[model samples]
Target: MLQLSCLCGQVRIALKQRPDFVNECNCTLCSKSGAHWSYFHPSDVEIEGETSQYSRQDKDDPAASVHFCPDCGSTTHFTLTESAISRFGNVQSGVNMLLADESDLAGVELRYPDGRAWFGETDFGYVREPRIIGQKDTQP
Candidate 1:
C-alpha cells in the first residue's frame, strides 16, 4: 500500500494498489514543478479529509480536470473527463506523486524535449533509473 499526503500532511491519499504506470514529463509546468508522476484508477485511490480543487474549463482541454490541495498547494492529479461520458463515470484515473516513499518508482515512460520550449540544461529530478539505485552489479 502506497500512502501519500499533502505537504502539511493535512490531506491524506492512500493507494491500495500500485499504479499501472509511473510517468515523467518535461512539460513546462511539470518540469518546473519538479514532481514524480503515477497513474491510478479512481477506485484505487482514497482521499481523507477535505481538500479544494482548482481548474477552469477550456475548449482546448475538453477532457481534463485538474485537482489539487489548496492548503498546501500540492498539485494532486488530473482526470480524463471524456472517458467518463462514455459509461466510465466521473471517477477516472489520474496522476499523483505525493507519496513520501518513492522506492517503488519504476521508470520514466516518455520524454518531451520541447515541452513548452522550457529547454535548457537537463534536470532529471524525477527519473527512476534503477541502475543508480545501487543496482550496479548488472553493469558489464
Candidate 2:
C-alpha cells in the first residue's frame, strides 16, 4: 500500500495500489494548492482522520469539494460534490500525490494537463508529454 499523510500527520491516505499516472495541472486552484492529482474510486483509497473542505465560490456549481488538514493547511484530496455526482456519477476522487514522498512515487507517470485553458465542457489539452518520475534527467 502507498501511504500518504499531511504535514501535521492528521490526515492520512492509503492506496491499495500505485496509480498508473497522475495529472499535474496548471489551473488556478490546482496551481495554488500545489496538488498533483492521482485519481481513483473512493473505494480504492482509505482516508483517516479529519479534514476541512472547501468548494469554489466562484463557480455556480462547483464540481469538487477539496479537503485539507485544518491544522497544517495541507491540501489532501478532493471528492466530487453531490451535484457533480448527480451529473457525472460516482466516478473518481483526486488524491494529492504531493503528500507522498517523491521516492515512493519514482516510477509513476506524471502528465501535464493544460487545465488553464479547460472550460469544463471539453477535453483537457496536454501542456507537454508525460514523464516518468525517476527517469534520467533530460533537462540540461
Candidate 3:
C-alpha cells in the first residue's frame, strides 16, 4: 500500500497497492496540471479530505473530472463521469509524484501517451514509448 497526500496535506489518499505503471499524458489539462496517472478501481483507493473539482468534456471521450486541493491548489486525482463509468467502468487516479515522500519508485514504469496528438485530431508526430522516469541511484 502507498500513502499519498497533497502539498498542504489537506487531502490524503491510500492506494491499495503500488502501481505497476504511471502515464504521463500530453493532454492540455494533464500538461498544465503535471499529473502522473495511476489507475484504480475507485474501490481500491481511500481518500480523506475536501477537494475542488473541475470537469472537462470532449466529443470523442467521456467527461473527466479532476479533483484538487482547495487550500494548496494541488491536483490530487481524477475520475470518470457517470456516463463514462457506465461505458468503461474504469477510473483513473492520478498522484502528484512531486508531493510524495521518498519511496521506492524504481520498479514503476513510466509511459508517455500522445494525448495531444490523438485527442487534438492531429497527425501522429509523437513517439509512443515507455520510458523509465524513476530509478534508484547507486552512487549514493
Candidate 4:
C-alpha cells in the first residue's frame, strides 16, 4: 500500500494502489503554499489521524475548496468540487505504512506546471537523476 504522514506525526493516510493524477499547481493559494498534489478517489484511500479542515466558500465559482492541516498550517490536499472529485489529492500525512519502504515508492513521479503567470518562477531542479526521485520536497 502507498502511505504518507505529516511532519509532526499527527496525521496519516494509505492508498492500496497508485493514484490516477499527480502534478503541481500554481494558483494563488497553491503558489503561496507551494504544494505538490497526488489525486485519488476517496474510496481508494484509508485515512487516520486528526485533520482539522479549514474550508472556504465563494459565490463566483461556488465550489472551489482546499484543505490544510491546522496543526502545521500545511496544505494537505483539496477537493476540486463537492459533487465529485471530492477527494482530489492525497497529501502525505503522518500515518506511515508499517512495512512500506523505497521499493514501493519507485514509480511515483512529480510534475511542474507553467499554467499561470503569477506563480512566480517554477523551478523543480534536476529530478531525472538517481539521488532524488522528485522534488525531494513536495512543496512547489
Best TM-score among the predictions, by candidate number: 2
lDDT of 4: 0.50
Local distance difference test, per candidate? 0.58, 0.94, 0.74, 0.50
Pairs clashing in candidate 4? 4-93, 5-93, 5-94, 6-93, 6-94, 11-94, 12-95
Listed per model in order, the count of residue pairs whose N, CA or C atoms clash below 3 Å is: 0, 0, 0, 7
| lDDT value, candidate 2, whole model | 0.94
Candidate 4 worst ten-residue window by lDDT: 90-99
Question: Model 3, 1-140: lDDT tens per residue?
Answer: 78888988999988888777777778888888868777777888888999998886555554678889999999988878777778766655556554455455566776777777684466534446575545643332
Considering TM-score, where higher is better, how would the candidates rank from best to worst?
A: 2, 3, 1, 4
lDDT of 3 at 126: 41
Q: Is candidate 2 or candidate 3 better by lDDT?
A: 2
lDDT of 2 at 9: 100
Q: Rank the candidates by lDDT, best first.
A: 2, 3, 1, 4
Relative to the true structure, candidate 4 reaches a TM of: 0.58
Give the clashing pairs for model 2.
none
Q: Write the per-residue lDDT of candidate 4 for residues 1-140, one digit (tens) a residue.
A: 77766655565667778643345545555566556566565666676666665344423443435555568665555555554334544333312222235455555554444445432366544323222233355444
Model 1 steric clash total? 0
Error at 96, model 3, angstroms:
4.1
RMSD to truth, every model: 6.8, 1.2, 4.2, 7.5
